[model samples]
Every structure is written in structure tokens, then in C-alpha cells.
Target: MSAADGSASAADGSVNALTSALWERRPQTSVRIVDAHAHVGPYSLFFIPDAGSDGMVRVMDRCGVSHAVISSHLAIQLDAAAGNAATAEVVGRAPDRFTGYLTVNPWQDPARELGMWGSDHRFGGIKLHPDLHDYPLTGGRYAPVWEFAQRTGCPVLTHTYDGSPYNDLPMVDEVAARYPDVAILAGHAGATPNGFDAAIEVARRRPGVVLEVCGSFNSGSDIARMVREVGADRVVYGSDFPFIDLRMSLGRVIFSGLTEEDRAAVLGGTMTRLLQWRSGRE
Candidate 1:
């Protein structure tokens, strides 16, 4: 067919009606998309206001994101107890759409708080920001938390990067080795360009260390490379929304050169499996 015949043309001046129809009818709806990392409360360090649950729900709907695993900025940047409480309340507001990750400081008795809130239906996992909280992942103080996670099959999402002062890849690797049963998410996959390879290396060596793609600048090719190296089962999609645009983070995976099954796993399936495993659904 030709443009002259009321059909679009390629550079070769050829076209197929069936190809056009199929392209027009391509699937518009998506499978369940989950943002595995997000913040709900204000960050005192950054001086930014909170992006409440309502704000996040609107963003999720706009991007066709079915669920988000969220933690509290207040917990990471300031008070762990209050932040966990706030996260629980927000997650409780929309149990179907949101899952809370109880943020805690290693120095504190995380187990005490974990005992109180760990079984709450609104909570799915734990979040630890060693860099922000200024605790080394290898420190003995964190051992109790690790033990608890391993025993309960709780996934821990930890802040990770190349040169962060506290818990970079090296420390994370050690922790992963120590707690083999605890599901660990490297929250940024080493959030910077230099950190990407390091994150991949750690994930490759440590079966428990799953890569979380959540930064604003993570490239599509980088995500695709992670899938190639570690398999889609070990990579989960996360937006780090409000801090970074949820759309931007989601776009990285959507446009990555991954097969349909791999892309689906990264976007939601991997996390879904992690959640189910944590909650004994697996």
C-alpha cells in the first residue's frame, strides 16, 4: 500500500494494512505495576514537605501503578518510631494500594518496635537507611534486626550507593552473607552511574541481594543489563517517588530492552513474589 492509496508509507514506500491494524490495537492497559520504594513523610534535611498518601495515589493512578511499597522519610531522616507509626497509618488508609516498610535505626531496639508493628497487615517489610541513619550495616547493632528479618522472611530495603559513608556495597555484601535468608533490596542499585556496576556485582555474588531500580537517573539500558546479569527475578522496580518523579522511574523499566516477561517481573512480579514469600504466601 502507498500513502497515495490512503495508507502510510515507510522509507521503502511500502505498507501493510494488517501491521497497521495490529499496531493500532496494541495493548494499552498494563499488568499490576508496583513502585517498590517511596517516601510518605517530610524530610527535615531536605526541607521538603510530605507527599501524603493521597498525593501518591493520584500519581500512581496517573501512571497506572497498581501498588507502592513505601517508607517514612521521618523514620529515615529523623525519628524512627514516629515515622513507622505514620507509615502504618498511611498504609492502613489504602491497604490494597500501599504497603508499609517499617523504617528503623539499628542502634535502637528495632526488634522491640518490630514485635509491635511487624505483624500489622499494613506492613510488608522493613526499610533501613544506613547512610541517613549513620549506622554501619556491618555493625553488631544491626545483627538483631538481621536475625529478626531472617526468622520472619522479612525483606529489608536498604539505602545503597557507591561511596556512601555508612553502608555501601561492601558492607551490604557482608550483611547479605550473614543473613542469607533475609531478602535484601539494594534500594538504589548503587544510585549513581559509577555505582551501577558495583550494585550488579554484589547482586550477582549474593543471591539474597535483589537490585531495586528506583533512582531518577537510572537508564533503561542499565536496567536491562541488570536483568541480563541477575535475571528478572532478582530485580524489582521502584520509583522513589516524590523524591524523584514516579513517572521517570517507571519509564526506565518500561522502555528497558527487556522481554515482556522480564519487564513484567521487574515492574511488579518480583516484588509481589517477595511480598508473598515474606507473608508466608509462598
Candidate 2:
């Protein structure tokens, strides 16, 4: 079905159809599935045997995820230039299946980094990891990145945690307040049970802010609650990919107590709209 078509109803046994497809390791064609937050390449701290683009595509195909927006581990943690280059190569290889987030390090020349790929179609958005970079979301260093996003109307996905001095909900809210044109994707949605409420409140307060449901700490019930509280349109699905298994993360949404329409919105509809917004500006 098309992303705009929300005809899949619970009474029509759509949930059962999705569950069966998921169990069989087949694509669920009933709705378009998109992974809003994912990472590529190996990490310094962990072992991911299949962390390459090919492996990521294999898993995405298995889970019926049509598209993924990813940033490389090297870009967020180690080197933004090399990591972003790797991400561009992945997108170039499979443009239909993948789009990248231009990772910007606040400590580095963010404006120059953004200028290099700001207009590159391979990148759909910008990614920030304040915690790993040891920078606050509201820091002056990120000003250029925020300005670029605001000017281009690009989506910015930033890692957020509950009460994290770097990227907590309050910090995100402050940035979102200033850059109203940029669609701020609150990555991980605070990342814990205790943080979900705060994430919800921030999303409620900021129309440009959207909640990304991922992270190993969240439950399906938490996703349902977020949907109930903020409405399905404000929540998007993310799997952190090789960092966490895609299968289990997807299962949480499929098996959750959400209607087929809500599930569709979270899985792809919202992200599709966000990406389209980016494309339109370009």
C-alpha cells in the first residue's frame, strides 16, 4: 500500500498479516516500512560482525524496511569527514534503499563540514551525538549546524537521554524553540522508561519536534503510550540497526497494541513526510 493510504484496519486482520510476514522473514508489503534512525559500520567499543552496508540491506529486506536514514559510527564518535564519506558511499551504492544523515562534530569546523555535503542529495538530514562528542545540544558550537538546518529546512536527528546534560529533552526543546524551521527528530525519545514522559511533553510543546521510538530500554507498551499521548503522527520508528537487532525492535511495534493505521504512521508515514520536506526544499 502507498504511504498515504491508511486503509489497513485492525478488523481486516492486517495485524495478523504483518505478524505472519514478519515471522516468515518476508517483506510486509501492506505498508511501507522505513527506519528513521540507524547506524552503519563497526563501532570502537562493540563487535558487529555484519555492520557493513550489504549486511544492513539484508536485514532491512528481511524486516521489509524499504528505506533507512543512517549515520556512520565513525562520523558520530571518531571522525565526521571519513564517517560521512563512508555514509555517502553506502548511499551511492544503494540510493533507493539508503539515505544518510550528515554527521557534524561541534568541536570541528561544522560549517565547513556542512558546506561539503549540505546540498548533497545522498544526505537527507543532519545527525548530532552530543553525549558521545561531549558537547551540549544548546552549545554555541552547534549554532552553524542548526542555522544550516533552519535555512535548508533539513531534519536534524540528535541523540537524547533523560536528564542528560548534553542532549536531554530540555536541551532539545531549547534548540527546537530557536530553529522553528528545522524538524528536530528527538532520537531515542529520551531512551528510558523514566524519560518517555519528558520526551512526550517536549514533542507536545514543539510542533517541529518528533519522537523516534528505539533504544533497547523502551517497551512496546511505551510506544503505545507515546502514540496515545502525542498522536501517531509525531512518533517514528527507528532500530539503531547493528547496534541493536532490527528484528526484535521491529517486533515491538508490530506486536504493540496499536491499530494498523497508527502502526503504519509510526513505521513510515511520518518519516516519509519528513524526508519529503527535506526534498522539497532541495
Best by TM-score: 2
* Candidates' RMSD to native: 6.2, 3.7
Pairs clashing within candidate 2 = none
Q: Write the per-residue lDDT of candidate 1 for residues 1-282, one digit (tens) a residue.
A: 566655323321222221232246442244678889988866665654447788878767766788999988887787888888899898888999999998878766787778778778788888989888788878887776788788888889999978888878888899988887788999999988878899899889999999998885579999999999999999999988777778778767776757667887998999998888545533
TM-scores of all predicted structures:
0.87, 0.94
Candidate 2 residue runs with Cα over 4 Å from true position:
1-12
Model 1 RMSD in angstroms = 6.2
Instruction: Give the clashing residue pairs of candidate 1, or none.
Output: none
Write candidate 2's Cα lDDT for 142-207 as tens digits.
999888888777889999999898999999889989987789999999998878989999989988
Q: What C-alpha lDDT, on a 0 to 100 scale, does residue 224 get in candidate 2?
A: 96
